[model samples]
Target: MTFQSSSKPQAFAPLSAESMAGGVYGWLTPYLIALAKQNAHIHSRLLHLTRTELHFIALCLALMGEKRDDADHFGAFARDYDRLPRRSLLANYIDTAGPGYSPKLATLVSKLAGRPWRMRSYLRLGELYAEPHARKTLCHLASISRWHLIALSRLPAPYRTYGVLRKIRKRYDLACVMFGIEVVRRVRTDMTDRQIIASLERSDTSRIRDWVEAHYERLPFPTAPTGALTDGTGAVSRPVATARDLFRAAREFDNCVDRYLWEALTGRSCFYRCDNGQRRIAVAELKRLPGVGWAVDEIRGPNNAELSGPERAQVFAMFREAGVLPAPQALSRFSWFDLE
Candidate 1:
């Protein structure tokens, strides 16, 4: 499970538990903050977790799941996390989202938090609510497919925020439904590469819509996500005006859907117990290059911690080579946010 370059094994900086947690938080915090600010009421109401704690929980869950049963180094982190107040906080949210908010969910969360989570269901549930699109996507999932797909298709691309990307993913979900595939089946588990590729094919949209409308009932309310981007009417903005921006958007969009196309296409979905799904998604974004094969292997290997600086630099270099990431000098010219 060690990473090897073509000629030899590459040396990597060792990862400590705290540093790993910090790495994940840094990557996710800004996105969560932006999302919280965009939907002020939703951020203030309904959810009680802060963006930092939410992000930390997700990273911890992903890490725990990825390293489960390995009696090695990661076991220590898992043991340490079990004792944290944060563990119960995550459990509380899950209980709230369960079959009912009270005793049912309360009972469920209590039972679940009493031990380490085994399956990704609870984790997935938490993640679904963490993104900006959680509400809209859940509504689409529970509603008529025909109207939802049509509306989503009408939305513009080069998606600038989580809201826009959610729309695109809804259309994708509809397309899968049109092919006689159920929304839950396409996600929430290990899927084969064949199933993944087949998703690209066209299907009978009208027939699928009819079936969905008849079979599924609309949900009671929008399932608000744990995080989101700004409401888009802000002076501070992140625009996808360049190839780098688009590539990054695509990565984030794939992330929003979680364990669908990116997982399957990259072969990460096939190894549910052993896989840390995000690595493959990141590697898949790397441009075709001389050293990329090795890079991908390194990313997919054990250790399963955050990418080291050299590894990140290598990935970025590939993007630069592919013309998706601009040079450092080029990035300084843009004003991403206003002072006001």
Candidate 2:
């Protein structure tokens, strides 16, 4: 089933309620009816939908099952259909008619819509859907979180095969649930996926977390541009340059700064330690926005607590002095962390 269109097709007439109620397009009726309750002019919008958009909605409705009642899902699909994965992949997955409304489907759709770079791997998964044990393989894939998917995307291509994914599902559940996502992420290096799985299976599980943490803490921090700042009143901020520093900071501040190593490593954002002379205070995260340049994304105290008003004011002043103050609307804008 070819999903690509070589030529511009004639405009399709607006679909009527009756035609959609029972026929080839009948699967879409439930979605249209549910969305119509929220949008009175849904039928009019349907007139503007391309064939691929219609099919995409149907596939989403089918996979989402009862969750299809949410109009925002449909709205997102309609607005970003062109940016979605190849129509062929969608059609092929729909043909499989696998499980419905699994966490995997949600993660898959979210990644497909929000992270276009991951589309190639998903497309590869779509190609594998026709093989034997596809349903089980898909179930395994769906069971893991988006973090695992991100980690999987970074692996060598050969390791992304169905066999490795099965191993990942099992190890991801055991290791991640036990050691947490940060440790799993920290341990993910070149040729480490299979080795980690093997070690977990063969070695004593009790020492794995310590080993992982030690392995992470011993690695030298990668060199990157820093955004360090100081207020000259014993107040200062320094960038977190290594996984070791992040791990130690997480332990000392009683926060999850370690979870953000991927962000820091990828240079999408930077984490900094805020201090007042010898007394540690807070952790500040900064990101470079399109128009805003470098802006403070968040500043949190110990235990991920929000800074007090006075303390926050001081931090903001320091950032302002450094010329990297966050815009009033910056927090409201989309962030890469939203994927988590």
Candidate 3:
């Protein structure tokens, strides 16, 4: 199913009726504006990258997840090789800006790349960054220019946006959710701690998968992996279990029940109001979990505010139905909910 079609068709509602005047949007607007400025600043600096560099930057932004534009945050994790010593394990592999072929990129292409006829964009780019041996087999020569020119050079004659760079930027944004969901599914079924560690030892794709799973599983309502998710380039595909269809229905029912209780208990939809110190701690913790660290910045995002309880409830309901989260616990311990 399409991402939108999976959720309830109801209008996207605010978490709280009372927050209608100004709540989530109010909190997010200024932050969004700041992000726009930062994107411009960063884009201006990125104009000179070759095609190879453009693709790597896209992957980095996708993996970074959230706040990819926060100069301080991005610099803290990206510039200093040892800045977040604890995160050095996940952060190091995607550090193309530091030097040559990114190990993480190498492993990804190694595992996912197909033979020439059917290769997908993601895997093709992965190959570009990782497979030096294959380069001699391909025909194109390298091209580089100002960022705008390079961006324009890649697009069709008639395009809507400023250039292909904008399209590339959007791809990174789309990848945040796609990869996030994929990571959750993989962590739930495909990987084990030992295997994950082994992949890390070799500096491979497993590092990214392992990191995603570790932090995702820590979420309050964790989904167990169903072992049915398939890896592909353009879109995710999963098979439905006909025999367990009833069980899926029951689980969704339970999700609604849990969502209600959560709202009743917390009186807020999203827990976005955590102070800077708390957010810093949370982001830091996530960065250490998987892949390149920047992706978390996008997932958590710069818009920090408690989602109105209703909106929070809606999100939970949607994700639960989508099976991203486990069935809500009837009596989840809320003492920790005080973290908000």
Cα lDDT tens digits for candidate 2, 1-340: 1122223222233345565565334546544444433343444464465543453354454543333334454444433344555443344333244423222333334223321222234434443333334434445553433344454554443334445444344544444434433465565665366665444444344444444554555454545334677777788888788778898899989988887766776678777888887777898777776665577777778887767767777778877886776545323344434312
Cα-lDDT of candidate 2: 0.53
Clashes of 3: 25
Cα lDDT for residue 252, model 2? 86
Task: Give a tens-digit lDDT track for model 1, residues 36-148.
Answer: 33334323531456434453544343434434323342333333443546545344333343332121211223222222222344444334334334424434342322333
Model 3: residues >4 Å from true position, as ranges? 1-56, 63-123, 138-140, 143-340
C-alpha TM-scores of all predictions: 0.18, 0.37, 0.18
Model 2 — which ten-residue stretch has the worst lDDT? 1-10
Instruction: Sort the candidates on TM-score, descending order.
Output: 2, 3, 1
Q: Flag regions of model 1 displaced more than 4 Å.
A: 1-62, 69-82, 87-130, 135-340
Instruction: Compose the digit string of candidate 3's lDDT tens values, residues 209-323.
Output: 3344333323332121222222222222222222132123224323222222232122322221111222220100001112321111111112222334543343334333434
Output the worst ten-in-a-row residue range by lDDT, candidate 3: 280-289
**Model 1, position 147: C-alpha lDDT score:** 36
TM-score of 1: 0.18
Q: Model-by-model lDDT, in order? A: 0.32, 0.53, 0.30
